[model samples]
Target: MGRIVLNGVRKAFGEVEVIPPLDLTIEDGEFVVFVGPSGCGKSTLLRLIAGLEDVTGGEISIDGRDATELPPAKRGLAMVFQSYALYPHMSVRKNIAFPMRMAGLPEGEQKRRIEAAAKALNLTDYLDRRPGQLSGGQRQRVAIGRAIVREPSAFLFDEPLSNLDAALRVGMRMEIGELHKSLATTMVYVTHDQVEAMTMADKIVVLRAGRIEQVGTPLELYRTPHNLFVAGFIGSPTMNLIGGAEAERHGARTIGVRPEHIASGSPDGAPWVGTVGLSEHLGSDTFLYVHGTGLAETVTVRADGEVPLRHGDRVGLTPNPDRIHRFDAEGSRL
Candidate 1:
């Protein structure tokens, strides 16, 4: 029952308004991700829901009750921050039990919740160790365990994996995804990393400068973006946007085609031809950066690893006509 709804929510500081009035509904048990570039106010929005920050206007509803004026402690939500924020002197067990102890739960109940959280986070053996003795990932798990014992209706994560190394981030990402499934609780996670949002979220809320650029499932946003901002931002390596003569031929102000959707071979009889400026062979896939196509940016093409193309070679590229995306002068999909 962790449904959260925001109606005309806005946030301001003095004369500047970071988040403008907006409406959003996060359904119960959905793993929703708020993702955007820096200073986009995704974290501020999350803080408003957690009651850590007050809204300048509008109402926030958690479940069925309005929580706009509630204090952070009474919001019934758990937040895991970018930093672990663990007490270096405290053991894992003590760290996890702090919340229950503050609420004056019985000794037995505190112990019960601590053990359950430890087991769930795979920290059963490390419970007696201090935060200083654990690895980065282990310490993060301890932080999550501390949050889990609160049994809040929803979990708020603010770039929880940003502190870890690449390998560790991947490991923790999968762990959090598993945690969501087992708990079946609504989770609102914030990250600037689109890869994280694409892989972990049931729904993604894309933001820019405090406003939502788009909201949909990973594939929905990938397959059919609402506008140029979304189309250019959503994909890896980005979709190639061509304008002027090429776009005019397609009866559009601009045309977009993904790298993988384009086929490359001999320059003869090809719709578009260019010289390969650079080529990257990454074992499983090969990427070619093509130049002299007359576009503002070099065209990037993803080809098979076995493709015998290299720098300085002439190549032809033909996009899958059915897969090409057309856009209007305003960057809206056509």
Candidate 2:
């Protein structure tokens, strides 16, 4: 059982509190991702759970036992860092065997586990090579293989894909997701990239300034955000927030509509009308930035890839009323 619970957990450095008291529960076999902008304290929280850092207040429990004071080695958990952390001089087989060797496992056991992890990670043919001989993705797999040998109740990942290029990041995302399915082990991942969080997590914990803004499935956060910060941060291209007279007419201090929810055309009585300032054709979809709509900033609309709307052309936009989001003056969802 890999269930982890934090009760009134807080962290402080000298006199300043970084993480205020908070409670969270990560269920067994669940893939949870903590996401936020830089210095949001997502990594700090993960380290608290890993026992690498002690909580300033309250306690932590793993499988129902208090582990607030346990050292990292006694916590029965494995962590994969942003860095590969492999010994360059060691061969792939020996790199994976390092952990088992440190624990004084028998030679036969070490060989067995190394071979099994290698086969699972598609490194069977590369076992004789050194870390210097592999690509970025291959080196990362070796790091994970090292963790797999520990057989911990849970796995913690600290931005494991940030070092790779965009294409490699996408491939590794799928590989990690597949690994979770095959292992059925609880995994907690951390990242600043919302796209990665949306694609890989069973549950997502959105944090900001050391506090959790929300916790729910990807779609839950996407469909109904708790507040303005969440609404603006969770979506790609982000939701357009309109204020002033346009918002006052709707009986809200501010109004929000996603790009995809707004349609572009030349409807005579459309709610918003503006000139297309720029159009980006990305093959699958076209993103149009419209100006002069009498709102706070440029309104972006997601139109068909083949949209003929060009710069200097006037266009009308209508948002689906049912999909409109209203916010109060204090930025809370109404």
Candidate 3:
């Protein structure tokens, strides 16, 4: 494993500039996730690191060695793609062993490495089976196994779980987390899913329009996002962002309160009042959508299992002041 550095990295296609001059330092063995909306350049940045795309300007180095001009094969990184990219005609064993064979390893070493990777990925039973014979999750594992067999200095994943069903995606997410723990290799994962980024990343890099919005731990981003974009992007059910003028006149500006931070009814020492408009019960908890008062749109609040409130129910909403996030007129945190 080795540290990866990007110094004033940039990419442009003719006159359309995609990534601006950006700087990042990825520590050796760290699991860093790059997350942003589509066309925001997260995948482009990952490709730049993998040597799949060249840097139009700036320098890239791995373990103190400059690698801007190096080809993908010489970059000492393995990339797993969303499509699995398994060979339909080759058995799982052959597919996993292909990289080793290409590298011209001894027969004994290649066989041993393939067996070890297959065992680690729980694919020993499917070694003789082709990609066509395995399930979606199994096929993804084969793709991962192929990367593992190469034993590169770092692993790059580009939405590797996007192709799987919800349950399988969760399972594969856990598998990838476990694999990182066991291997402890440098990893850079690119995804638009905030849930995946939050749950699996040791550090999260939130991007917007080819620029980095913020970089921090999951909870750090959740608890204290630097601006409105991040405040809205990092959480589920999203955050309720009231306008700065309206909020400040009421003692706060651009007030942000999470769904889980709001409670039903006019609790003692509550901050604001709104009528309930809709409610969603998810077994473990209920979400109350409130309207009316200073807020322009429906604001969501979390309730304990099965809120008795219904549509058009006249109820008061209160936000915990300590839990609220205040942002300035420009959306920067205040």
Residue 328 Cα positional deviation in candidate 1, in Å, after optimal superposition: 1.2
TM-score of 2: 0.98
Ranking by lDDT: 2, 1, 3
lDDT of 3: 0.90
Which parts of model 2 have CA positions greater than 4 angstroms off?
none
Clashes of 1: 0
Give per-residue CA lDDT, model 2, range 1-334, as digits (tens): 8999999999999998999999999999999999999999999999999998989998999999999999988888999999999999999999999989999999998888888899889999999999999999999999999999988999999999999999999999999999999999999999999999999999999999999999999999998988899999998888999999988988999989999999999948998899999999999899999999998569999999999999999999999899889999999899
Per-candidate Cα lDDT values, in order, are: 0.93, 0.95, 0.90
Range of the 10 consecutive residues with the lowest summed lDDT in candidate 3: 263-272
lDDT of 3 by residue, 1-334 (tens): 6699999999998999899999999999999999999989999999999999989999999989999999999999999999988889999999999898899999999988888888889999999999999999999999999999998999999999999999999999999999999999999999999999999999999999899999999999999999999999999889988874668764656879898887677534455677777788889998888888567678888888767888877776767768989887788998
TM-score of every model? Answer: 0.98, 0.98, 0.96
Per-residue lDDT of candidate 1, residues 124-237 (tens digit): 999999999999999999999989999998999999999999999999999999999999999999999999999999999999888998999999999898888888888888
Cα deviation of 294, candidate 3, in Å: 3.1
Better of 1 and 3 by lDDT: 1
Candidate 1, 313: how far from true, in Å? 1.4
